[model samples]
Target: MQSHNQARANAARRRQAETGESYAAALAAIRQDRLNEADHATEAGNPPVDRGPDYFHDKPVPEVLTELVRYHSHRIAKHLYFAMDEGRWRSDFAEWQAMTLYKLTDAAAHLNLLIGTITAYLRDEGVGRYFLRRYLQVNQDHQVEAYLTPRVEEHLAGLTGQPAPEHSIIWHSVGSDIASQSGWNHPEQHEALEAALHALYGNYPDDDEAFNHLPPALRERVLALIPLMKDQEHSGAAD
Candidate 1:
């Protein structure tokens, strides 16, 4: 910014000498030229960038950074509570699918995009250097993140969750995760079983409730698995 101011002042002096204008008038003219340039750049879809200070310009950088971290922490905690709470829970495949259930929401995609954009931006800006050498990853507790749990594999293995052991808690399993979990042995069968679990289970704690929830014809279709599996894991067929 200092270099830019110096360059602008030099231009104003030259303009004043050439146009026989007062120093103040010359400076005003130079400023107007820059405004016009910025307008043109915006029209061209190449908006100009001269990052010096943001709107909270009076605050020191450390103070600004501190406030950002504090408030964003509150924002993130609220987000997690809202997402993970029983009544508002979400994941990869809320919509029905042949594969058990991938997720109940698209939040993972949103979080990944956030991580990609912010990390790239911080590194591009010189500020990212502060932690680069000292930290193994930027996606540490310092930033938002997304990941999968073993439960996803559980779901894929045709392990329907058991009824809530208590009102607030549900123990999820079908058979031994190792026994039921298998490689893609029978593609068509696996696909059938995977889909059937989510569709049949359908948030019902009991198998009968899930079966009753669906029309008889479609009820069994939900369990179709690709990399196939079944809890108690038998459909009178070979794996």
Candidate 2:
């Protein structure tokens, strides 16, 4: 009986690993597409709104990064807890696939347009270097970042001719693998997530200098987000 039980446990573990892998692959693909869309949107001249630093002008950079890390950590923890619950918490595989697929689609659409505009402005103002630097600094702390941070950093670092340490790369890759196994539903958690992201974007190196580097349309988008970022700051504080 003991041997039989051990075999069953092993089988269950295998299944969980497989499920997590499938989920992670799907998520990574979705994020990639979203990033691409942002670039495409900017190139097409259909720029989205950019909320200026009012979004996060008053906030500190390290605080923003910390918030982002906490938000994701909380999200991942909740999802993992639910996914591992074999009782009332057990979710159907179909549900997991469907939900993540839709989330990816939406996230990609939003990012494509936003990132496109943001990058265009960065290119114009010659602030891509600032962005690259800030991103690198925040991502070097792999102990806390999500799976996406290092991956994005790796690609961005390559663009800047900076080599990412092998250990950091491995750590993020493993984190991503672990994240793929989670599947918790919590839109309520987005408040904190958005706040952190807004803070990071708001605290760009130099507002005037960076703005000058961006294209007109891209500038408009950045300008638009400033308010939103500020709102998020207020919201985060209130919470």
Candidate 3:
């Protein structure tokens, strides 16, 4: 009976091996496909910067969120750039532009998942739930700034409403926390940024400074999201 069971198990194993996909192989294939697509996009004038696992991690809430937005924005940009570069986009006129804008907006909305992750971490910290909720509102402001900042000035202006005391202080601390950290490494950083900018603007910025220095259109996008940054500030000040 034991021999029969062993034979049956061996047969099952052989069958599984013949039909099943290896998880590692599948992952490797996916990565290879992505890399190929990225290379093709770059050749077509869109650079690809794959955001690796290391780029996202445990860090101060504000800082991590801010970086995530930056990183996420670049990914969206690269994705779009490749889409257009590969001739996947059908049109480039104003109507098409509007559609592209919507895509970018959608990308921004999708990034809220990352935002939620950071918010949860902050909540776990000494930060209060109320403050985290408000902080989320402020983080939205930052996203508005970094994403739409380059596209709309008036929008950004309106986005930066009078930040409450908590929002102001906490947001900066977060930014400071991220800025102080030893990140921004990895090769894809600049390439992703450039691709994102080139897709939105006619030209890409030379560096993060150049990108941030972009006229109110892009700068205001990030600027628009600042009020939420102040939520923690107000909460702390309230104490």
Candidate 4:
């Protein structure tokens, strides 16, 4: 994995130099920093950055749901970048673009799961219908909403028994919007962003395949750690 990441980073740098694009160069730098961090942590006998609390903990459901959204949102953003890069390089534009869309759909499905879980938790907490209705309102103007698959929207509408709010942040789309914008705009910046994503995540199975393959126990553990990891990343950035 490390070698693969390094090779991708090198390629990104070369691309950036050839095209005067900054995206790949920026990504290579970030990847190097992360690799260094990982090495230092391993040497110090510290747990990996992503290692976190077990899934079946007694934490508040809202908290757990929040973390799940954060974690998957990060993953989805990485995949989105990769898909974008694939679109840039591959001759089969339609196929690559469809793959990208599939990744986005997978992201939406994961978020829908988090929303369902949160709703159930709110009900248990005795949040009244009025409050719940207000809670579900789409209050934000987020670009991430553009990526939400129609199927996921339909599924959420079925669950709510009303049309899903056309503009809600239910999936924590705010975080996704930020992730998606990290290396946007200039060509170099975009390529660098793509390089960083490829280095970090490589290619993973599509969302449905990955979700279906997970054992229940492992899945829960992953759910528990997702938010915790996000918190750690934020804290690290702050520091």
Candidate 5:
């Protein structure tokens, strides 16, 4: 029989293949699911523990949520850049451009909704808006590189033939980072965000930005094989 660790590693690899998540992210999800299951089993015999909306483990709620707001805001900044870059990529690749923008907008909408709710709950719109608007203000100032150096670094690494690093290396999008923190303090909102994400991208809304930023010719060749990849994913699911 396979050892438990081997089973978990295999499960994570399958998840990474199907969801296009980095290996660390897929592993994190697997571990988190196990934890959630264990917690649920434990709670089944006990009374539910309820807390106030503003409760963040006794930390200043607004302060912590504001940081969550920053995380989403940063991701939204990257989406905006990618949306424009798609158009700038080449005037002739209209299908690719349209697909990118369509997916990106769906991605942005999720993040925007998260920002709006976080601000409303904090009862101070300025708390979120100030940080969000600064990202937008990159147009008037020379803040693009300073604001998005991490994203640029991914593309740079890809150009040099490096594989995508583990999630710890790019902590910006860790589970407790931008992607899963969508209203996590609120149980209902957390479930809703999870559903919306699966619906929007058929997985996570994030693209492998580094892979997408590869030279157009090479990227196109890979994209053209996507249907075959989909078949592989389905077969893995069956197993």
Candidate 6:
């Protein structure tokens, strides 16, 4: 029996042959139809997990790196909550357990890819060294963080002698402008950027010169977020 996706692929091939359409175009159309069906299913309150590509897979290298760092950081943050309250929850325990298991399994599948992507970016990007340092500082996974931080620090220590705070300062600075230009419309992107910035700023609590190494425009944007960072610090202290 032909599976649904197989049937769709066959139909797409037929359409491609009949209309002289590119295979890529046919596949894109099929994907769009599948997405539309998924959207309809969601609207009917029976939301389906699409489980397509990871959010960053198709993005440019810089954006991919940004999202990779943000995603893992968010995962680590959630793990902290899960760790602290593993058995205390009563309501939604089943659902939470299912989702947590799924995320853990899924993340494990992608761990190697995530590491490879970051390594590739660090090797290829023009400001790779700076970004590598920032990633090391901001990432909360202690095992990988401990391993990579010293290696990166040692490699660049001779030239710069310290971590370059400007990478994150510039990344978040540009990210804010990008988010604002979209009128802060993309809640998911905004949330991801906020998480990334929180992680970045959280690592440099007392560094008054954190943004000083950034370009003027980027520095201005980063400096503007000091109040928010301070607020986070206060909230953390209260907790």
Candidate 3 residue-wise lDDT, 1-239, digit = tens: 24322343344455457768553343334446666975675567532243222223334335444554565455565656654653455655756666667666666654553454454444334454344445455544444234322122221121222223332433333333334432432334744464444444331221223234455664655434334445766889999
Model 1 spans with C-alpha error above 4 angstroms: 46-239
Which digits, one per residue and each the tens of the lDDT, describe model 2 over residues 66-169? Answer: 33344345555445444445334546777766655555555453333223323333343344344433533444433223323434454333333346546554
Report the C-alpha lDDT of model 1 over 58-85, residue by residue, as the tens digit: 4444432222223223334344445555
Alpha-carbon runs more than 4 Å astray in model 5: 1-61, 123-239
Off by over 4 Å in 6: 1-90, 118-205, 213-218, 232-239
Lowest lDDT 10-mer window, candidate 2?
176-185
Model 1: lDDT of residue 207:
20
Residue 218's lDDT within candidate 1 is: 52
Worst 10 residues of 6 by lDDT: 152-161
Worst 10 residues of 1 by lDDT: 169-178
Score each candidate by Cα lDDT: 0.40, 0.43, 0.44, 0.49, 0.49, 0.49
- Model 5 TM-score (2 dp): 0.26
Q: List pairs with backbone clashes in candidate 5.
A: none
Whole-model lDDT, model 6: 0.49
Model 4 Cα lDDT, one tens digit per residue, 1-239: 24544465666566667778575455555557767976675577643233122222335544334333445455556666677776777788778878877877776665565465454545544554444445555444232243345544443343334444556544334223323432221333333443344323432221212223345654454445555656888999999
Candidate 1 residue 106 C-alpha distance from true site, Å: 50
The predicted structure with the larger TM-score, 1 or 5, is 5
The candidate with the higher lDDT, 2 or 4, is 4
lDDT of 4: 0.49
Prediction-by-prediction clash tally: 29, 24, 33, 8, 0, 0
Q: Which residue segments of model 3 deviate by more than 4 Å?
A: 1-67, 82-110, 138-186, 190-239
Tell me the TM-score of model 4. Answer: 0.31
